[model samples]
Target chain A: MGATIGRSIQCGGHRTLWASQGRSRETRQRAEAEGFEEVTALVDLCAQSDVIVSVCPPHAAAQLAEQVAGTGYGGVYVDANAIPPALAGRIGELIVGAGGGYVDGSIIGPPARASGSTRVYLSGTGAASVAELFDAGAADAVVLDGFFTSASALKMVYAAYTKGSAALLLSVLGGARSLRVDEALRLEWAMSIPELPARSDRLLEYSGRKAWRFEGEMRFISETFESAGLPGGFHSAAAEIYRRLGGQADESFPVAHEQTLTDLLAGAEPAPFDPTR
Target chain B: MGATIGRSIQCGGHRTLWASQGRSRETRQRAEAEGFEEVTALVDLCAQSDVIVSVCPPHAAAQLAEQVAGTGYGGVYVDANAIPPALAGRIGELIVGAGGGYVDGSIIGPPARASGSTRVYLSGTGAASVAELFDAGAADAVVLDGFFTSASALKMVYAAYTKGSAALLLSVLGGARSLRVDEALRLEWAMSIPELPARSDRLLEYSGRKAWRFEGEMRFISETFESAGLPGGFHSAAAEIYRRLGGQADESFPVAHEQTLTDLLAGAEPAPFDPTR
Candidate 1:
């Protein structure tokens, strides 16, 4: 995603520099091939670029923000990672205290591997300026008129449905398998909600390999809900489901051909059902 | 439902009788108006009818089956209610011990108010005979080839998604409201999942009035999942959500326009989120 966005910046007639501090050799080669200028130090990249966008794993968002803050580079810092709003607010504080302009941003849809498939939503005072930097790119950069943390909040709740429903379907199908009525339940779904069976298949195709990412993402989403005083048990369970699914390729992900997927989930069961009234 | 099924039985050219032991005056009047023979004594009704179909509330299914079995009713006794398979098996035992032919049945969809909206799914050896009772009716009585309890198993898992997803949306929407991003969350949902905004409102309309029923239904669903060695937390939380909603009308049900719903849910919070790193 970072490479693709950097290419988009270059297409918009701006010089894009990437810090090769801890990146892989393959990524460095790809960045160089994609018209990106790779720099050895984070400070050198910060000093040269007018905007620094952080797009990494959820767990690394804070660490990257802190590293940029330590450099004391007063550039427009856009943290476009999937983290809880409170954590984004904390990162905002970290950047502002270091005399850097902060923009809370979140990317929806997917990576800009193709045109019209992704969007970058930005919030905060510097959001419009940051959006302007990616004008007419592969992804649309839209500025939101809200507090700095609003973009992150939107991402958290939006994912609470997309990935959350996948976990819910997994739980539902597993429970049906355990009860020995999976086919009957699926038939009922077809009669009542015809979209669900296809939707489950779509989740398997798209979210199977991404389950590893969703594990941490759902944990942060759970925290986001808990911070607002709502029950976080659903997404917490979702995180556990994703943890069990891991990062298997889409083709290797278990489908409902037999009882394979449900059997895998059922093996992780804590106990047998209590038959008492 | 009873009236519609009774009319179907009468249309099938059979003597249909109903026991009015504890029924209301209005119900008795409606039973007579719908061509059902209303009997004043339970034993008399049990002795006269060729088959007795038990359709009542979830909590009352056991009691009614016990009452009929105590009368030594040797005819086909069909237990059709929304309950777990274990409870259905228990009711099957109660009827069979008294020399009665037991057929486990479950009704999906609404009551047979008109036509093409309800189905009565039946199982067990006597299911074929019981299905013959509703030869031509507003409701479709389809016999399933399985154990006496398979029909209820289907019902348990099927409702887990239909009503379960409704409760999940309520939690998601109410959480978004608490975080002060309800509109933003709705906008994102509209963009990504076009079905969700209307689906949420549909839940508020249908599930709200029926939440009182869903509270117990979700509890039984939780037990059903737990019996199958799956986690019961989702339906348990769903039961609590419905319990908090408590069967309000749509106008009185809390909406995103206010904070009334989230406040009630937040009251049941266990603990605030720990902000420690």
Candidate 2:
């Protein structure tokens, strides 16, 4: 997603710089394929760039922000990862406290490989300027007139359904399978919710491939729900669902639906509730 | 729902007998409107009926079954409530142990006011006979070729998503409202999931009215998930969501969406995790 976003910025005629010191070979290849200038050190990348967009897994967003903050380079910092609103706000404070401009951003839809397929929602102080960088590019950049954390809040809530419901459908299918009523449930759904059986099949095919990334995102969403004074258990359970499928992330092809269902059932031991997580 | 189902059975040219001694005035009126013969005592109703169908709140299913068992009514008993498969199995055992033919049944969809909109799934020993009772009636009756508990298991997984996703959407909307990004989130959803904003509104208006009933059903679903060797937290949290809105069950009309949101936010205290519940 980061490489694709960089490509979008480059399409707008801006020079995009990336630090590949600790990134995977695939990450380096993807970034290089997008023609992004690679800097060997984080400090060098920070010093050379006017704007730094952080797009990584939810777990890595804060650490990357801290690393950029440590370099003492005061530039427009865009945190475009999926994290809780409070975490986005804290990251904003970290960046602004270091004399840098902060923009809370979240990427919606898929990677911006085609026009109108994705949106980059920007909020906070430098949002407009960052939006300008994606002008007429593949990713439609929308500047939001709300607090800095609103972008992250929007992302959290948006995925709260799309991904959350996927996890839920998977869990339901798994439960039905465990109870030996999977076929009956499918036939019943066909008469009512006609879309569900196919949807469940698609979730089984695709979700496990990305479950590793989604596990952390679900936790962030759980925290986001808790911070907003709602129960966090939905996404917390979704995280457990994804964690069970996390092993399939490295598979070369989409794991067979039955295999994924077996994996899910094998990991059915309920995790102890931890409020502190 | 019970009265409606009775009406559907009556439409099939069967005499419907209902015990209205402990029922609410509205329930009695509904039953009378359906032309069901009212029996003053449950034992009398049990003694006169060839087959008894129990359709009540999920929490009351067990108690009602036990009461019927105590009557020593050696007739066909159909447990048609929204309950876990295991509970359905237990109820089936109690009925069969008392020298009665047990039919595991579950009504899916809404009250059977019209054909094709609702179905009553039946399994077990007297399932075919129970299905025959609804022949050419408002609710489509289908008998499964599996264990008796398959009917309840199907209902558990089916509602686990339909109602579970509704609770989730409400929570996400409430969370967005709490973060003061409700409008932004709605706008984003409009561009992505066009159905959500109005769906959330409908949920806020309608879900609260039936939340009291659904709260118990959600817990049953949670237990069903656990019994099927899956995490139960999704529906457990959904139960909490419905519990928050349980106050609206008695409203004269649909409560305003904002009031429902406020009600949800006000009851956001996290409940302790109870594995035993």
Candidate 3:
């Protein structure tokens, strides 16, 4: 997802590099081999690269923002992590405090490699100024144009229902299996009425790949829903389900999650149906 | 809907009449003019008709079962009321005890005329045997040749999730509106997700007409989910929402609801996000 998004800008005549934590020699070597500068220090990367996009963990979003301009970095500090809107606003504050422009860009749908088609939402102070960089060229991101953190707010509200309903369906199916009502009834109800199976399948399919991203996304959604005066717990509950995936080397992320659910539903006995009289 | 469903059955060469209490005499006269029998006496109709299908209030299902059988009605007794599966099981026992060929059937979909097909899942001791009556010729139904009360059980499960999720979404959206965020971020999240709005529309659209049925269904599902070892209170929560809607007559369940949401969001007034949060 990130690679396609990054390449979209690069091929579109923008000096964009596939910058990472340099977590692996593969990514670092690939960045260098691909004719993009791979800098180890934040100062050099921030100075050289026109846009410094950070896709780190949620808690790390603030710290990452703090360091962008502190290390003699002078560019747009694009915080793309799924932190709470409050946190996003705080990150914006930190970016501006560090003499760097802040853009609260929230990516929706899947990232694409093709130019002028990558779906993203950008908002915040100096958001209107960055339009030529993202909205115009290869990557066509829609401007949320709301409040600074509203983009993240939008991401969280959407997640509460999308992921919440998906989580609810799975949980009920577990109950249904326990009641021994047959899986077909669950599938039929899912297909006929609620239609969350497809969404759940998609989440489970992608969570393995985006487990790290989902973790922060889940937390942001939980707090957002809480702030919005709805159930904060649904996102947290989904987070619990995906908490096992990603951000860990041993965790297989989303694909590994598919295995977890399969195994959980396989040998796992459905709780017996016993309506207490 | 029930009147139309009754008329559809009357079309299939059998002598069928509808006996809805308190319906206008003009309506009955219209049915009679249309070459169909319409009466007020349950015993009179039970004696004349070969099949006594009791599609009424949940509390009335068992009463009809007991009263009709006491009239020495030897015809088929089809209790198609949306009652508890266990209650349906007991009603089946009541009809058989009264020397009637009982078929415990539950209609999952809406009532229909001749065009749209409505399913009748059958159960009980003589369930399969009575398929000849409802599923034999023109009556559109899927008679499950299985355990007694399975039809009702399946219906209970479907209602639990459908209604339960509706309640959850409404409650959460209430939370989202009251949240103070970057106005831009909030709108982005709202537009980004579609599940809550889609579902809100459905609930508001049908709540008034469905309030009574939903109350009974909520009772069955609350127990069924509990039987399945899930949190059962969700349906109870849904029942409360509709019950509130019952007082307003012109409330186009969905329209009134959407307006309520709009007013809440438009005011920018702070309200509780999650009820329990």
Candidate 4:
């Protein structure tokens, strides 16, 4: 996703640079194929770039922001990862405190391969400047009129439904399979909601490969919901669902649907009920 | 809904009877309008009917079955409500132990006002007979080839996503509203998922009026998930969401969208997180 974002930036007539000291060989190859200039050190990359976009997994967003801030390189820093608003605000503060412009940003779709397929939402003081970098690219840059964390807030709420509902469906399917009523459930779904069986099929096809990354994102969304004074248990459950499928992240082959159901049910015993929490 | 189901059964050329001793005047009026014959006592109703269909709230299902069982009803008992399979099985046992044939049943979709709008799924030894009662009627009856609780299990899993996702979207909308990013989130949704804004609107319109009943249903779904060794927190959270809106059940008119949002956010403080549960 980061390499594709860099490719979009380069498509907008901007020079994109990456510090690939610890990245995987596949990532290096992808970035190199996208014609990104590679820098050997983080400080060197931070010092040379006018605008830096961070697009990584949710767990790595803050640490990468802190590492970039520690270099004391003043530039527009875009943290475009799925994270809670409070964390996004703190990252913005960390960057701004270190003499750099911070733009709270979030990417909302697949990698920007074509127009209308992806959106880059930006807020904060440096939003317009960062938006300009994607003006001529496939990624649509949307500058929201609100506080800096609005971008991250939107991202959290958006994915809270899409990905959260997918996790709910997977759990439902797993439960039905466990109870030996899966076929009946599918028949009922076909009779009532005709779209769901296909949606569940797509989840089995795609979710396992992305579950590792989504687990962290679900946790972040849980925290986001908690911060907004709603129940966080929905995404917390979603995180558990993704965690069960996390092992399939490195299978190198498509997991069979039945195997995925088995993996989901392997250790998913419910916690004991407590009247007092 | 009970009255509508009675009307559908009557449409199939069967005489529908209800014991209205303690039922409210509104229910009595609805039952009378549906041309259902009213019996003055529970024991009298039990002796006269060949098949007793219990269509009530999830929480009331067991007690209703028990009440009818205490009358020594020997007819086929069909429990058509949203409840966990275990509870349905227990109810079936209670009925069967009382010399009654048990047919585990569940009703999906709205009340049986039209042919295609509702389904009555049945299982167990008496399923065929119960399905025959709804034939040539507005309610389409489907009998599954499995255990008695298969119908209830199908209902549990089906609703685990439909109503559960509605609760999730309500929470997401409430969170966005609380954080003041609702409009921006809607715009992002319009760009990515175009169907969501209208779906969220429909939730605000329809959910509050039915939330009082859905609360127990969500808890039943949570237990259903837990019994299957899956995480129950999704429906637990959904139960909380429904609990907050349960007050709307008695409202004389439709709730405004903004008012519903305010009601949802009211007293929704996050519980303190416990690392160990």
lDDT scores for all predictions? 0.77, 0.86, 0.59, 0.87
Candidate 4 structure quality by residue, lDDT tens digits, A126-195:
7998888887888888898878778888899989999999999999989888777889888878878999
Model 3 agreement with the true structure over B1-277: per-residue lDDT tens digits: 4455455555655676767466677667656655667678777787788777777765566777888878888877877776666677677667778777777677665555443355666666666655554533334555654466666676666655666677556645554445433343334445544344555566555545556556556666666655554555455545554454444445544556555454323433343322121
Score residue A142 of candidate 3 by CA lDDT: 66
Give DockQ per model, in order. 0.38, 0.43, 0.21, 0.46
Off by over 4 Å in 2: A269-277, B269-277
Deviation from native of the Cα of residue B109 in model 3, angstroms: 2.8
Better of 3 and 4 by TM-score: 4
List the candidates ranked by DockQ, beginning with the highest. Answer: 4, 2, 1, 3
Off by over 4 Å in 3: A9-36, A41-51, A56-76, A93-101, A135-137, A160-219, A231-277, B4-104, B136-139, B145-147, B156-226, B229-249, B252-277
lDDT of each residue in B148-259, candidate 2, tens digit only: 7888888899999999999999888888887777898888788878988888878888888889999999999998888677888899989989999999978866679889
RMSD of each: 4.0, 5.1, 6.5, 4.2
- Taking the tens digit of each residue's C-alpha lDDT, what string does model 2 give over A138-179? 999998886777788889988998999999999998987887
Mark the regions of model 1 whose C-alpha exceeds 4 Å error after superposition. Answer: A21-33, A41-48, A70-74, A113-116, A247-266, A269-277, B19-33, B40-50, B66-73, B113-116, B247-277
iRMSD values, candidates in order: 4.5, 10.0, 6.4, 7.9
lDDT of 3: 0.59
List candidate 4 stretches off by more than 4 Å. Answer: A252-254, A269-277, B252-254, B270-277
With a 3 Å backbone cut-off (N, CA, C), the pairs that clash in candidate 2 are none
- Model 2 chain A is weakest, by summed lDDT over 10 consecutive residues, at A268-277
